[model samples]
Target: MDFGSSLGPIRPRRSGRLGDTVVTYLVDRIVSADYPVDSALPTEPELCEEFGVSRTVVRESIKLLEEKGLVRATPGRGTRVLEPPGWNLLDPIVLEAQIRHDRELKILDDLISVRAALESDMAAATARTIKAPQQQELADQLDVLADLLDDAGAYAAEDVAFHELIMVASGNRLGHAIIHSIHSKARLSSRYNGTPTRADQEQSMAEHRQIEALIRAGDADGVAVLMRTHIVGSWNRRRPEVHRSLTALPTVE
Candidate 1:
């Protein structure tokens, strides 16, 4: 509850709102388990003093945390940290923190699993509904991706674009938004190694070409199966790197 030392120095942000700064500080502590679940958080006065912020800013930060399910503030017992299941992983701040914690937990494997499931469905749906320019766009993306096979950074960007285009073309706006959010967080995390080897790029390109062919042929079932296979295969190829990251992380007590 007393996170004074663990919370580190409270330097004011040069541009952002003080409340948001306080929120980031609290969210980081909560996710890192510096303020363990069910433990009482420092009082408003204590937080105010610690962050050198006003009661209003501290109060706003705690409110935001509550909205994200990171804590529950009781009238008399004060605020208490909640367990991971209690938190809203869809919340961007929480998602970022979750990915950070994932380096140790291998939570990205679970995320990839979910992504595979969603993308398979998205691919099938898009294949069913894809139109002229979008279909053409998907076809052209493969060529662009192939050309960038030697450029890891460029290939990664195109890889993201290729997948995002499918999701958007699926006409499932909500699904696209969700996948976009997932990729955004995952891309920022160290767990996602965006730089691929030449072989990896070639493999990805081949799978994508199959995906394009399936979509163009209107093979929904084939696209679904291939998409799932592609996702799992890609992750399997990088399993060693992922395993290394997991093993090297210091175990959180």
Candidate 2:
């Protein structure tokens, strides 16, 4: 309700503009259901006074929220928050908000499924076309993973890099973008859970090693199978209570 201290006077910044800060605050509130669907946002005058900004900044922020399908503005009726289905989940801002605060864990499940499908094809493509230098790059990442077995946080970071390299090398720019987006957002959430045990880390490393070997051998089928297995396996190891079969993942043509 109070945006005074929260969305205070926007200082001069090169990166996050004044409008962006307000947009982020409003998106967070909407995603958190603090502004439930059909609920009216604070009036323009109220927001201007609360954030110590002119009507221009407040109006721009509200416009942005509307563009992201988060709200509907009417002349007589104030801006009304919309339902989740109306939101643009693929939009980076909205996705980050969901990842940072969604408690239902549904977003995490969707992320895993998407990653599994895309990485399977990426792995296949990488295996078929990867050059020696890229292969070495992947090998180097594996070495880093092995060395960081004792450090979960560092290991997880390198692990993402390892896969990111493959996605890049696969020559699928769009796929890489989507996967990277998911990774960047997940890293900020509880969903990016890393291996917690020495044994678990060892298993993850083994899977990466196998995938690397398949790529070196140019075994596309093997690469696809192992990549999906590794992805799903990692998820299971991290959250044993949650099990979702990856068998339904379509094979890369």
Candidate 3:
């Protein structure tokens, strides 16, 4: 009862109603696989058999994929997976296409935005009542940031823990909820890429310390400022970098 992916480079003419057929099969497969970015496409025969169509039908089907930048055919090399902009990852179809293709998930962008929103709210809540131990914990994390910052993966992990602590300091049920929605793609990405430069980590640690100081002073606005700076700063750092693989990133811890 499963329909094949009609979304990508299915051959036209041989396959009737080019767009619908291509979209159906293509969308189904991508959705099933979660539309990962930069992943490889299935063999032509696979699409043919799956779609209950001929090779020409499958060939035309993939054409649509090329238009979306979701796939390409190398003639003898068959098809390679691709997921570039305009794939509408925010759209369910593109998301599935990227995931299906095994493209690197656009994790950093989403995760950082979530952190900005969650941490900012957490900082505001903490300003109302930050406990003595919690304040010290924040300070300790800042110091730790200064120390083991040579390890980017560890630094990212600690960064997440630091932000999560702010949520805990808020002393509200919403804290846990925020953590659940907030993701750790940044940390996971760091781990995948191994460690970055010590200088990078040091700068990050310094930023955390500044935020901790603001939180300790019960300056919600100041904490908010620092949190925004950290989030935006991290985004700016990674914005220039490119990633490989589009899906199945380590779940945010």
**Tens digits of lDDT, candidate 2, 191-213:** 45844788888898998999999
lDDT per model vs. reference: 0.82, 0.82, 0.62
lDDT of 1 by residue, 161-246 (tens): 99999999998888788878877887875457644679998889999999999999999999999999999888877664445434
- Candidate that scores best on TM-score: 1
Ranking of candidates on TM-score, top first: 1, 2, 3
Off by over 4 Å in 1: 1-16, 240-253
TM-score, per-candidate, Cα-based: 0.89, 0.87, 0.53
lDDT of 3 by residue, 94-167 (tens): 44333333334344455557667777777877876998998888888877766766667667777778877888
The global Cα lDDT (0 to 1) of model 3 is 0.62
- lDDT score for residue 167 of model 3: 83
Instruction: Name every residue pair that clashes in candidate 2.
Output: none
